[model samples]
Target: MLDLTKLAQQMQGISQQLTLEATATRQRLDRAQLLMAQANERQADLVQMQELWRDRLNFTAAMPLESLDTRIEIAAPPAAHTVIATDGSQIAPSHHEIAYCYLINVGRIILHYGQSKLPLLDSLPEVFYRPEDLYVSRQWGIRTEEWMGYQRTALEAQILAELAQALTDEMEAPTLALTDGSLIYWFLEQLPAEARDRILAPILAAWDQLRAISVPLVGYISASRSGEALNFLRLQSCPYLAPDCMTHCSEVVDRAPCQVLDPLKDAALWAIRLEPGQRSPLWKSSARIQEFYGDHAIHFCYVNVGSEIARVEVPAWVAADEDMLQSALSLVLGQVQKGYGYPVALAEAHNQAVVRGGDRARFFALLEQQMIKAGLRNVGTSYKETRKRGSIA
Candidate 1:
């Protein structure tokens, strides 16, 4: 149990830190705007600087497209449009469990507004216990959660692709598809080359399906903490010609010129750059994982949908097309308005996919029952697990 008294003692310090940060952020926002203007005027220079720095640039920064300060009012959504979203939940495998297995459930939601068809809400659950399924990651002793997360992400994309492609072919009006988080598979960068390839295969295939069908696919993140745009803006104000952190910052203790914008994130910065129902210009992500993504490299923009700024990401294919990009943001804004600041379809997809504590308990109980029915003994059942459960208060 958490010690309330200890937590309460630190609460005051936390509050003080927040106050100091907020004050500093206000100061930085002023400078950030000035630097943004300077940077916008030199987009070509900044792009060149990125190329010159290339592999040496320590920070992951975004590339400005045309203008950094460009803001477009929310597109008037089509009268009849469809928005579909998919979210995934997983039960990671554990040795402490009765069954050493994992589960992935993808929740699919399709909401039709100003159309005759009723909403579609369903979930697809899959279990993995086979040796091939359990050890797909190729890591000897790494934690299972990371591999499970990738599997769930792939499943969500595949299911969303099937739904979106069918709807795009069938419907006359525009159709949009959304996944809960980013399209950038940044996590895969940490894995071995073979493992990364194995995991990314299905995800790229799913993206190809939607791309072939010309269905706009989006990755939605609410109150995103992505520092891509903020990091890019910081480059404009760097004191050094090259902004080489490794060589130049060896003697500097603190970020004298750049730390002024330390507290700002993409969402917070875009909030100042945009008004309600407006979106900032698109920017391409510079994550190293993009090297592997190739044509599906991720691009993103910030949208102020009344309550807060939300980050919306898309594949390179969708981002390059003006009509498709506008249709996506407009429908996203409409969904946010309907849900009162969040996407309604994504919200419902989460509700259908979430695996709670009680559900986890029942799942293990069912596993134990099935093992007993199969006339097999759970010989390696965890002793510490039972001890923890039966401990006297």
Candidate 2:
């Protein structure tokens, strides 16, 4: 038989080693469990923070009604004189095609004029004229290249010159020229020195002449629906106010007292009270806040133009709720259609194809039919066909 005492001692040492190993492994497992629990806690905290942020934003976006006190009154239209509403539209590629469409109405007589640069692509150099009085097409040497900047400048100069000439040629003596937009044209800065001088010199001269003759030179922007101020108000869930009111509010918000307000705080306050189709006018006193606050305090006053009376000054960031995006877009589109007379009827034409069913001949036939319906006489259609060669026998 072996030595019992020696075997017992060896077994005890082995058991001790196994017990130490098991204790170490259990400690490691406990550490891992603690780390996992900490990670889960951090995740929950993050989620809670996000939820709090959203709630805060939503609350600040709620509309505030503190200063809306003015009563609503519809102003009568000003005494109608010879009103001429002129609008200019510019297209890209070759800026040569600058379209200046104007509506001149004196009493019952209405005159519409659209002057555009005739595109001389390839070898054709021509000027197409279509007016209420005369329809004339003449070949004029005008070349346009692919350079957008140079083309834009050249086209603006040409159009401005044409506009000045048209003003003198069409109107007898000095007459009032009422432009449909802002007095200063934004594109004026983009033109070259010579072109700029050429374009503006005559315009200023015309203005001087009009001033001398007591002819009023008025410009009306007609409350642009796409204005940034209006859009911001709409996004903030406050669209009922006039564009000018929103503009004033934006100005105030940028200043001292209002700027200090936490974005989320303001948004929460404004979002709750601001309703759809709500409108308010910011007062002159509020507009002069900079004078009162001395570059420190923020002040805004608004008179409710909407049926409901709620006025709130809020930060822009609070207004950027994701839920407001679609509503803002719809409001903008509606405003654009109502204010700008954008063609809602012809919206389907936006997707209409030039050719359909992969049949070129049929497309031409359909085009001719459309032309005929549009009162074009003696409409003709022609096309070139490609033929495939037969394989050699």
Candidate 3:
């Protein structure tokens, strides 16, 4: 009986050890599965890159540029300058409702207009303006209204025509044009080449005139909050606001000190200036910083601008400092890249106003109403409620 009892105790100990080992082995298997998943994701990304390169190479090889004796002209920055900031705002109907976006572009030019020390010229034509309403179907799956195909093309043509008129009538000749987004919309791919050429030709002609007079063109895009770089920054515990803040990620890794404070109240705030530094892993190889916010944050250039790059950090408390103002302008540029493929307008109508918590429900309600008004079909609510009866007598 004593030997039997000792044998039972040893068996119990061996069983417990086996159970522990089984658990550990299961955990190792789970870890291996997770690693395999990650590797597969990386492999997929590599395949996508290869496909993109193939497409790009094919497109470039098929399109050959006609070369001419084109002389390259470089323009020097003005000793004393006035900066003109222009922006455009639009509210257009999507498939189901309307959407709003704005653009702001800024540039410095030799003060040509009046006696005022301010660099702003009152006579300068508005670079940013809103055009007439365009009724178009929302085929892009972004918003859900279906309009005729020609509607989008017509609206784009009107926008381009208005832009050309503004450039000719109000803008000074030989002045730099600073745009908040890409010079051309990527959606141009959907339009016929002849139509695209017709719309862009005038704009290019205006640009050439400015270039001939030694005026440089620059485009700036802000950081996007929803972008991969900013998302990574948020995950890494960097300070940033949501929704209203710009979203695109920058590839440059540089830091500059900036004072972010309320100047009117004499209070201090947290602000940092961005200085260009080494390339970051986050940036695409060809990316360049048009504006910098801090280490690992910058507004990147998506289009070529012939202007000299300058950066300045300012205290947030100072109500206005031109150099600092330019930094703030950089954020607008970033927003253009992240939000809409256009520059931000400088006017108050185009300003990115913050929505308060109290207004959240109201905003959505208005949006729903607008969709209804726009004739977008909707499905019934997906909710049901049940009430329990009180105790019966």
Which model scores highest in lDDT? 1
How well does model 1 score by local distance difference test?
0.84
RMSD of each: 2.1, 24.9, 20.6
After superposing candidate 3 on the true structure, give the runs of residues whose Cα lies further than 4 Å from its correct spot.
1-79, 91-175, 224-393
Q: Each model's C-alpha lDDT? A: 0.84, 0.30, 0.30
Point out where model 1 deviates above 4 Å: 3-6, 138-141, 244-246, 250-253, 256-259, 378-381
Judging by TM-score against the true structure, name the best candidate: 1
TM-scores vs. true structure, each candidate: 0.93, 0.26, 0.30
| Better lDDT candidate (1, 2) | 1
Question: What is the per-residue lDDT of model 1 for residues 270-342, given as tens digits with 9 covering 90 to 100?
Answer: 8777899888888899998888887998999988989898999999999999999999999999988899889
The true-structure Cα RMSD of candidate 2 reads: 24.9
lDDT of 3 by residue, 11-57 (tens): 98899998987676555444433432443345444334433443222
Ranking by TM-score: 1, 3, 2
Model 3 lDDT, residue 302, Cα: 18
Worst 10 residues of 1 by lDDT: 136-145
